[model samples]
Target: MDNFLIITCVHHFQKDGKFYGYGPFIREMNLWIKNRKKVTVLAPLIYSGIPGKIDLEYEHPHLNFKSVPAYHIQSWIARFKALFQVPYILLMIFWEMSKASHIHIRTPGNMGLLAMFVQILFPFKFKTIKYAGNWDPKSEQPHTYKIQRRLANSPFFTRNAKVLVYGNWADNSSNVVPFFTASYSETEIEPVRKSSLKEKIKLVFVGSIYSGKNPEVGIYLSKILKDKGIDFEFIYCGDGVMRPQMEELSIQLDLSENVKFLGNVTSAEIKSILKESHFLIFISKTEGWPKAVAEAMFWGCIPFTSPVSCVPEMVGNGERGVLLSTNPEEIYLALLPYIDDEELFQKTSKQAMDWSRKFTLEKFQKEIVNLECE
Candidate 1:
């Protein structure tokens, strides 16, 4: 309980002559290390030749960082490199884990999967694995992902450990705990007003503009609206490999005027956009409890998303917003009615805001504190 050791697959980088990592991941960890005496982070710290748009440095001072060589199962070459490197990584984890009584592993990732196996060597150490991805017990996924879930969910395998997951799945292990992540603190909460349907519809799509999250779905939504001569704007708030491709597709669809891509912005900037936006079009192919969806709902921005993972429960089974289909035509038809009905729009926005506010960072941090202390 004195020292908190964090392990994850999130790559750390150096920019502006300072160490940096993903903003939201660092922010959540910042909340976690509040009461701890010493905090340590062990993960792959890559040296990117060029600068990144979303890299954020850790906020705490005088903290320890152990940079392990980053590896993945993406390509055959990478897999071969990892085969020789994994043993060294495991040795490093074993040594680092021995130094702390409290170990936190960020799961559904390659590094986390490795940590899950090594933690068995230290059953006496209390560990918490935060499964940041989809946790549907029956959901189809890769072998590695399934193995990590199996190891963590078995009391016999992973002793003295607890898993923090998005949803409450039936027939779970004793250590599996239902939990949530938050972006804003209780003090950051403000009076949220419903967006007016009379104005030009503004849709915000947050998350990496990758094929998996399907930024194309948002663009297609804009295309459908534009074809009907409807006045609306779709703004993408994150950057990824598919960003350029999505941008080109937007122009090709003749949606140049309606679609806007704001590469990557800070948490503050996104919240400002969410406050004024009418809907968050996050029709991703996969997600856990996406912080973007919850943040949008927190500011009275209705969500228009696919029922991936626990999104249906998060969006109140389409009561708070629109649940979409794979077909762009069907998605358009489902949303067009809400666009025209001002009263219905106002009602759902309120319900969404109320639900999201209940899961603030203050509450989230308290849960982490309890788990860490115990």
Candidate 2:
């Protein structure tokens, strides 16, 4: 049987016995595995209550899942133990990697590090690394993350590998290829019923309310719109460590009437909410490919996001979306012009939707086939 070893640090196969996270990544793999009679997943698993996995159903005849302890370290002792656990984990993955004709890895994680080291032992192996994170060299990151990127891109370190990254970054090795996640399709496209430009606009922010995502920016922008006498409401979906702080900021800005936090939601529910929103406010400082932003664009919601990682590329270099400035005041002033422009809004929404439609599951699977082929 043709075998493939898929490795990652993220909790892919959860204890709930369902795969989640990196939805597009896993979905593409599931499709590609059809070519191989046998496929094995080597990754962490966590217990959860999430109903359905992203791609695979519960019973896939050709799939084999081997989960390791979630790469978790709290104290110095735990951290030391984790360090020792790396070799054993690598041994487990190497066994599968040796048997497989193709090897796929998700990098910048504990498991990724182990795989990276093991990959060095088999320089002739055919492998691919899907790096689902901000690839900007200048962006601040953990030491291990920086090391992983360097090693994975280094000519001497990484050979016979294709390193897939979210956005196009400078000075990348020949192996680095830019990629994107898809949402809807040409057939799925429908006429969006937009609200009147004269009426209150509905806005949305769907992601963690953390420093990286900068949920505060959404609140600040909403307050600016309110002060400008613009009738608008911003809804935030997704809970995070910074939820309490963000809620406090909303109240402090007297934006309680204009902003609502709906917390985390399911994909179906999120899609329904997007249909009702006019724009998606994502001021994230960094991203590989923000799925929420792409999803928003798919539903005809214009995105207002900071030009981080591949965001500019994803949004068609601001043709279909708004780019944020480092200065908060500048961002507020820049967007004020679009507050009442109906034609601009419609054109931008259509452009966003059209751009997102180009990257579909069918297209993604085709690319993977090419990558796996000689």
Per-model TM-score on C-alpha atoms: 0.95, 0.89
Runs of candidate 1 with Cα error greater than 4 angstroms are 15-18, 49-53
Give the top-scoring candidate (lDDT): 1
| lDDT, each prediction | 0.85, 0.78
Query: Could you report the Cα RMSD, in angstroms, for every candidate shown?
Result: 1.7, 2.8
Report the C-alpha displacement of residue 60, candidate 2, in angstroms.
3.0
Residue 76's C-alpha lDDT in candidate 1? 98
For model 1, give the RMSD to the true fold.
Answer: 1.7
Candidate 1, poorest ten consecutive residues by summed lDDT: 48-57
- Tens-place lDDT per residue, model 1, 114-193, is 99999999888889888888889778788898899999999898999989888888868899998898988889888866
Point out the worst 10-residue segment of candidate 2 by lDDT: 51-60
Q: Please report the TM-score between candidate 2 and the true structure.
A: 0.89
lDDT of 2 by residue, 101-211 (tens): 778888888788778878887778888888878889988888888888998888688889888888767789987877766655456667678777578888899887788
Which residue segments of model 2 deviate by more than 4 Å? 12-25, 47-59, 72-77, 326-328
